[model samples]
Target: MSIHVVLYEPEIPANTGNIARTCAGTHSHLHLIHPLGFSTDDRMLKRAGCDYWPNVQIEHHDRFSDIPEKYPNAVFYFIETIGEKNVYDFDYSNPDADYFFVFGKETTGLPSELTDQFKEQCFRIPQTDLVRSLNLSNTAAIVVYEALRQQAFAPIAIKEAAD
Candidate 1:
């Protein structure tokens, strides 16, 4: 199965870097949506990611809708603060179809319009108490592992899936 980690307008390069490293280690595809806060050449991200940035398989998308064109067979799963379905409840392991795990900007989360437009596409990562949400990279790490666990941690399936 193929997995795509989509970050919607991520603000912090370090967070993105860490997420990229996680994606590299897990062998998941990383997608960074447009209007990023920092440049791809940011020193902080470079430091946080070290040399792992090149190891990760990443794609850049100008818009969320562009994703479907790139992976027509994939399912888009957006993560947000308020979601009808708890992330834990969703079946990440289903191998019948490809999946894309979408996340929003760290500061304001996702745009309401996008969330409302894709209401059925939204999902939540379970949290407790006063915390609003987890760090972007951390959240990505958690969700990616769950997906990996479900897919038996397949080895770089993107190349084959795109074929």
Candidate 2:
């Protein structure tokens, strides 16, 4: 009943690290599909993620297709610029269902063949024509927050200020 952020062939260490930090804060699991651009121990990655690396739950996969096999019952949504539906249009309020947000690499997006196969599950963040695409980390945070909002930020939503 939690959210999972899946990065497909992410090429930038900083972006992945930042996303990992976001995942740690939101209590979401992170799935990284190879082949990764940088080693898991890269300094930039650690720096961007700060000291939150231990707080993040990360799983690495050798292939993208292996994700579905691992989480057969979870609902998956692929994020792409050419997606048919807007991210806000989807309902992420199911407390009993596990949701996975799949994003592409920094340079080239998810494979067209794969996206085409799951065309109905594809989603995109609205943007102006001024920019080609949003940054990978930014996009992941935006979508993750939206999903969290729809679910009323359950489990992680705090009402009282920390002392």
Candidate 3:
């Protein structure tokens, strides 16, 4: 019944801070994959986060593989430009599931090694060809909120499944 927001090798501090704030508000756990561009205690990060850091459930990992190993039962959904599925295609309301939405670095989307291994799990927000991609913080908000929206009705879904 937990939702996780994974930031893979994230760069911008403000963006990470903003995403952290969103994670706090949604009650989602935040996972940061290392080789980060800035220190976690950066002034910009602290400022953008504005004390919400105290409320966020956060974890740090040296590698992305570490996460799957630690939470083997969790379902991972990677967000990439080359993904086959749209954001709305999946059902996030499964009561027994723990979900992780993985977002990549701002400058270079996700690593091919990851995208290749988890191609089926990758997803996109569905945009026109005119834009390369949306802002990192904004994209994180979109996917996280969508997951929350679906989970909001989990009681009905659970009841239906129990029938």
Candidate 4:
């Protein structure tokens, strides 16, 4: 019933922190696959999350394969530059199942070996050569919001319960 954002071998602490903040705001879970470039307890990371750490549901894993083992039925969408389809191409209408959006590290994106296994599920955010790729946090936000939008923007507590 929730979305999961996976950062594969993330190299930057601030990016992860900012992503964590976004996840907290959207009620999504943040998954970090090691080995991270910076320690999770880093001060800069803490500063970037800006006191929202308590609100974010974070998980750590030693390997990416561990995620599939944990959630075998989870739907994964790999985010990489080589993906033939953009985010808008997919139908994320299933709100009952957990959607896992896998984003590569800030440096070198997800390995081709991994993407090859799930090429159909891979997606990219359109951009020009103005930069190598969009920022990690920015990309995550874009994909998550699109998925949420496709789902009618429901199931995320659009309104609080009335007494």
Highest-scoring model, TM-score: 2
- Order the candidates by TM-score, highest first — what do you get? 2, 4, 3, 1
Q: Can you write out model 3's per-residue Cα lDDT over 64-111, one digit (the tens) per residue?
A: 999999999999999999999999999998889999999999999999
TM-scores, all models, native as reference: 0.86, 0.93, 0.89, 0.91
- Candidate 4 lDDT: 0.89
Q: Local distance difference test, per candidate?
A: 0.82, 0.91, 0.88, 0.89
Per-residue CA lDDT of model 2 for 57-158, tens digit only, reads 899999877988988889999999999899999999998989999999889999998799999999899999999899999999999999999988994867
Per-residue lDDT over 1-163 for candidate 1, one digit per residue giving the tens place of the 0 to 100 score: 7778999999887888788888888778999999999888657555664687778788998998899887888987788878888677777777777789989999999889888988987888788858978888888888888877767776445445564
- The superposed Cα distance between candidate 3 and the true structure at residue 47, in angstroms, equals 4.4
**Which residue pairs of candidate 3 clash?**
none
Off by over 4 Å in 3: 42-49, 153-163
- Who is ahead in TM-score, 2 or 4? 2
Clashes of 1: 0
State in Å the error of residue 73, model 1: 1.3
RMSD of every candidate to native, in Å, equals 5.5, 1.8, 5.6, 2.8
